[model samples]
Target: MKQVLVIVLALFIVGCSSTSKVALSEDRFLLTSNDPEYGYTENKPIELGGFLRGTKSAGAHIEYFEGLMGPNGEKVKVTRLGSCCEFEDKSMPFGGGLLDRYQLTYEGQKKPVIIYVNLYKFNKPLAPMGFALL
Candidate 1:
């Protein structure tokens, strides 16, 4: 009986402890919208979707950055993008996640360039936080 109980407890603990680590990859799961227009690609004028603002009780965590990349892989003019009153959450457990979408353009580039998107954090100039490619 003791062994059985110990085994059960161990199994329970293992099951409860199992958690999927949040990876900042190009995985589709990172996207909060299903507009099919959000993601990395050769497509210019990428769309940085919007999100719903979190409430006082339960909030969402959403962040984004955009910029143009240079030939030497240098980021320039990094911009912090957010929804209306969404970035105002300066408290713990940030407000709601992104829901709406915004667009960006890759102009003035004479050659093939790379654009990036950093999620949930401020990426450096031309540096994406989540996932991005040329």
Candidate 2:
């Protein structure tokens, strides 16, 4: 009985630790918008793609850069875009990453436009990553 109790306690501790790690990783990248028209928005869906760094077996890093073009042809470059880890869980086919949202405001516009950028890197074999405005 004592051995069983010890095993159960160890399992429980390991499970909680794993959960906390995931949560911490998730919180690293934050999603936020500042458009009064849209109010505060969080956790918006985003498509991921672009230059990938690292490998699946040893973990990977995903990188993407995009720009927002205004009606006048002015372009705003998005820097420090986003990132995701590709080797969190091997059992799961798909790996999870972080999402970032940006709000662009310009003169003469009544409201700012909200853009969603998703960063994802998975261990499973997948297609090259890229992103498009939605």
Candidate 3:
């Protein structure tokens, strides 16, 4: 009887430990964008489509950078994208990098929220003489 009791106790401990690990691993962040239109704007808002997850109690950060422009007046350069993670709450404001501003909008209750971010506030002027809008 003593051996059986010890075995059961060990099994219970193992099960509890596994459960805790799974709970920790369940946290994650999700980001997506669609119908993306890029242009240089002064204090203009750009719509970034995406959803976030694993942020039940907090919000995430997002980074934005300017892309290179082609001769045909099109953007070609791409920079490192930043991200937000574990925000204090969904209502908290989060932004990063150049023009790092994000507005999150959620659908009803069960749907993912849309993240609208401004991309140019973080960009630096290319020419020392003057600044040109893309």
Candidate 4:
């Protein structure tokens, strides 16, 4: 019985960690992460892709960056145009529901900007969460 329980627990953990991919359109894809620290470890800029799916409260933590840095270490302008959180989970803190949509304006940007989304509620100041150069 103990061995069975262990197997079940292991399976459960693995299942919970698995990623879910949603196709928004032909070129756009949605990547989800139960762990909020998904694309935040690398210290380099991330080439903009489709979209980042994490906590809805991600917008609150986004106000910390001055702008994005280009691959050549040049400063790229970043502006938070808007945000949309239609799908939200109230159970989560600060209403960080299913998805927090953030629209940004990138000046002279032709690619994506890498950012670190702050998963912690208390930590207001944070690194880049991620950016889409569009």
**lDDT (0 to 1) per candidate:** 0.34, 0.37, 0.29, 0.36
Residue-wise C-alpha lDDT for candidate 2, range 20-125, written one tens digit per residue: 2111222222222222222123343333433244533222213322322333323334434343323343533465444555555543456655554443423222
Which regions of candidate 4 fall more than 4 Å away from where they truly are?
A: 1-63, 93-108, 111-134
Q: What TM-score does candidate 1 get on C-alpha atoms?
A: 0.24
Kindly give the stretch of ten consecutive residues in candidate 4 with the minimal lDDT sum: 21-30
C-alpha lDDT of residue 121 in model 1: 33
In the range 2-92, model 3's lDDT, one tens digit per residue, is 9999999999999875542211111111111122322223233342222244332112123222321222222222332344322232333
Residue 48 error, candidate 4, Å: 18
Candidate 4 residues 1-134, lDDT tens each?
Answer: 99999999999988765422122232211222223453343322222322334655444443333433332234445544333333333654556422222333343456653333323333323223332111
Q: What is the lDDT of residue 29 in candidate 1?
A: 29
- TM, every model: 0.24, 0.32, 0.21, 0.29
Candidate 4, position 132, lDDT: 16
- The residue ranges of model 1 lying beyond 4 angstroms of the native Cα positions read 20-26, 29-134
